[model samples]
Target chain A: MNLDFSFFTLNIISNFIIKGLLFSIKLTLVTLVCGLIIGTMIAMMRLSKFKILNYPALGYVVLIRSLPFVMVILWVFILIPLVIGKSIGSENSAYITYIVFESAFYSEIMRSGIQSVKKEQMQAGYAVGLTYFQSMRYIILPQAFRNMLPVILTQTIVLFQDTSLVYAIGAYDLLKGFEIVSKNFNRPVEAYLIAAVVYFIICFSLSYGVKLTQRKVQIAK
Target chain B: MHYTFNWSFFFKSIGGKETYLTWLVTAWEWTLTISFFGFLVAFILGAIVGIFRTTNNKYLVTFGNIWTEIFRNIPLLVQIFLWYHVIPHFIPIINKAPRIVLVVMAIGLFTSSRVSENFKSGIQSLSIAQKHAGLALGLNTLQLYWYALLPQAIRIIIPTLTSEAMNIIKNSSVAFAISIAELTMFAMQAQEETARGIEIYLVVSVLYFISAFAVNLISQFIEHKIKIPNQTFVKQ
Candidate 1:
């Protein structure tokens, strides 16, 4: 088949591509913000001295980590409507699911970061008059967060890429937009190539940013 | 309306005493088969790429980086969709092959990047003295890798490999998106037919959990057994 590639067609597709990119950015950003907050809380709970605080957090991590992200997404989509008596739009539901799923993973990352902080720092903080929570807030957490920045960024990039899976759940993210465009034009190759380029651009830039930040962090240290 | 705890319903679905057994067995078979084949392909391809990435040759290293980045960044679901729907049209010769092959290939390619990274790091961690010793002993490149390097590398990599295996098992669920009738797909189908989504999903989760837990335990045991001795026995 001799295919005619036209400027007008390219222009039209570019608009859809931009929209898809915007949707992807929105999902990634919202999920990161929300997931990080929930993940930090869970991490704190997991790291708590009390068994009552730690065990439930441990169970949450194990259970969520064991199941596939797709299963969790489906469970939320299916169960939410049945149980809550309200329909969640595909886009919102995808964000919600990503937040929940990514939080479990990010919590582990945060817990490890917290654990990596030296015992001396905590001891010194106690040597001063500051309480445990105050010391964590003022000293230990700052160091841990600094150390964790590169890893957290890498995980964020991974989470951003993974947001594409929302396409499976009917969210109109970049990949889903490509699927729609490909079906419309019956040109899956062009559509997919375009999508791949966009994804590569995003991921590559994030990786480069991570490298740059790591160097900066090292120099500062 | 609250979901009543129907003990009989849950039991019948899980025990394989009812019609649900057919779906469960089929799903279990499909999931295991896909994961096994996919892991095999990924291991071979990943090992080659991993070794290539660690080579002194700059071009080969660039190729490895490009390959890993491309595969690792893209969502596996999109890759599967592209393989199933798009690739067949691009290569008319392969139109006769089953879609399952394409799905398997997609999974293998996507996973190879991760496995390759793990293997490359494992191999790179070997001491410079070990490579020198292999060279001094008049071993060829292949022999150096096979006899001197790989044994230790494999020992270091067992934990990572276990996690990768678990990843492949979980990822095989993407096969269901292409109508592969894997465990997840089977559960979805059964749920549709029976309107028992929660019960079927819980059972499916348990199935995945058991296999993943088994892999974890075996890897932990192997890792414990393989700890390097503190005393130096220099090959060089």
Candidate 2:
């Protein structure tokens, strides 16, 4: 098989690659923020003393964890529009789906973090006349957050990698950009190799960052 | 603007007198068949590579790392497409083999990275004393891994392997893009014919959910049976 590498074609692929990387970065950051907020709330509910609060969170985790990410994305893209009586843009819909699917796993991660904190931490805060919520906010959360940083970062890497699935819904993410290039130029190996290298760089950097943060946390401790 | 619920149409779509049931059954069969074969390939290859990963053999360890990096970084769908669309054009002999074998090989190769990681971590978690004991008994490298290291690693890795199996099932959906006639493709075609996209997808989701749940539950049960005492030192 003869392989042709054209400068003009490479330029086009590079342009699309930059756009795809930007979109992936935006998706990853937005999902991390939204997922953290929603996941924190769900973690709180899961750890609540009341059954009413806990069950809903439990239900959410089970449902989300069981459903495939692609199915969830399809559900949001197709069903949400039907249900809400309005058209959601493809990018926004994809972002929403990512957050929704990610929060379940993140919440479980956060819940474990919270549970790993000793009961005395909460008790110590309460003994100083802090409210239950205040104690959790001040004492439990700070420590748990520190302990969970590496895991959270690892999840962020996973989320970053998973952003490629947005290609299913025409989101023009990294994988989709590669697909377009490969299809257009009939150079599947080159296109895929470029995309794979970019992904590996991002994920490997995130993992390395996690290691650094972990060391800093340990040193501080 | 809700679409009317056509119960008969939905039922006929999935349970029709035509090839709907046949397609569903065949799809289920193919999904399970692919998953089992893929898991077997991954398990055997992963075990060897996983052992190599923890070994002092620099060449073996480097090979394992490269394999993992290449496979794990790429999306399964892209890899499946590459294997199906691109690899055949490169290799003439394998290209002549039937499509089913090629698809199975693709799935197996794609899933093996995860299996290798799981197995490597499992082996790493075992204490050095175990290896010492194996050597004390005059066991060779192969014999030590077979008689001592692998048995313990297998127990440690079962839960992880179970999750990997579920992942294999999920990844098998990508095979649909290559016209493998798995469950997801079945749903897609059925939806196109019936124009009931929502219901068809819902059914497909439920099917996947139930199968995944069943696999998880069975694995959990097996894990409980093979519970290794004092193995809690390697906390996740």
Candidate 3:
């Protein structure tokens, strides 16, 4: 019932919270780029006509989607080093894990985006004598990406929220910063309260942008 | 560095009383328990809050939006930490509450936002004339919703809610972060005791997939069984 806030100063905020925030942001951006790349490849695989190209991609998206993100994080952090015969560090493992895990989600989004491009567009590309990859690169991808940008952005918001999970692997994420402050100041209440508020503010603001983007995307369509 | 995969770790008793496989099964039971109870809370509260958001009253609508945004925006893990660490400090009685109870509450509150969003869209998607017709028929607000709205809205949202149901199962994994001894906890502990980290995590993930996929199949079965012939209102 009793709480104190005097321990929370700008110095502590800058030293711990801001540092952790930068890492979280870095993780999100890095994973978004890498995930989209791998995910696009997977999406193309799934969209291919041959079973060799398709089944593995579908299996991947299904399998990865089914497991919890926490399992993926912990599993990546713990098992990858043993498998690969070297220590990649928790942060690197985290980056790898998010890319692998998020690729499944992004691949689905990518599949839908690619499918949304009219079949006639691809035919038109063929008529123009462009190869399939060339047409995909030049024409369909642009429209597909435009169609699914809002969805990808929405997924990023989820990614931003998910970065807090690295705290379990003992990484210095935003939540980890709060944990340290709580441990240092002996004020779990203030530390966690501030954490919740900060997370809410960032996500809520981002969601407002998502809503705006949805409107714009709809209008553009 | 070299490693050989040990597929036989499940046979040996890690704790002397039970095999590591048994420990994982027990954790699976914990996960299902959290998902089941958490779904109960999420469904009831989310339905109510969803109703609030869609109501004619401005204050209720605002309160509902705030509730949805607050719960939805905050990471469930952060909320779990607050529930596990902070809430007990403020509410003295919650200190005595079971960890299972608090974890369930956290998951429930976290997921209710999504469920509420589903329900809000479900209700809003219905024809406005349904509401007008119910009022014209002299049904009060409660009767109008209960008789004229909820049944149809529920029907409309079965698929979305199916994902939400699976989501509760997935999200219940966060309970392990609070040391709930769930599937993830068993994976970590069993790995520490036995160096077969990959096998343990793989086995645990498969268990999660089986349950979530089972839910998916069952919902699909129900969706198939309950189809109104030629009604294209539901998604394929």
Candidate with maximal DockQ: 3
Q: How close is candidate 3 to the true structure, as a TM-score?
A: 0.95
User: i-RMS, every candidate?
Assistant: 2.2, 2.4, 1.7
Residue A177 of model 1 has an lDDT of 76
State the displacement of the C-alpha of residue B121, model 3, in Å, after optimal TM-score superposition. 0.9
* lDDT score, candidate 1: 0.82
Model 3 achieves a DockQ score of: 0.73
Q: Residue by residue across B124-153, what tens digits does model 2's lDDT show?
A: 898888889899999999999898888888
Pairs clashing within candidate 1: none
Stretches of model 2 off by over 4 angstroms after superposition: A7-10, B1-4, B10-17, B97-103, B224-236
Model 3 residue B170 lDDT score: 90
Least accurate 10 contiguous residues by lDDT in model 3 chain B: B227-236
Clash count for each candidate, listed in order shown: 0, 0, 0
Give RMSD to native, each candidate: 3.1, 2.9, 2.0
DockQ order, best first, reads 3, 1, 2
- Which candidate leads the pack in TM-score? 3
lDDT (C-alpha) at residue B21 in model 1: 69
Cα lDDT tens digits, model 1, A1-221, are: 33334422767667666677788899889988888889988999998989999999999999988987778877887788787788888787888888888899889888888898888989999999889889888988888778888988999998888877776578777887787777777777677766777787888889899999999877877
lDDT of each: 0.82, 0.80, 0.90
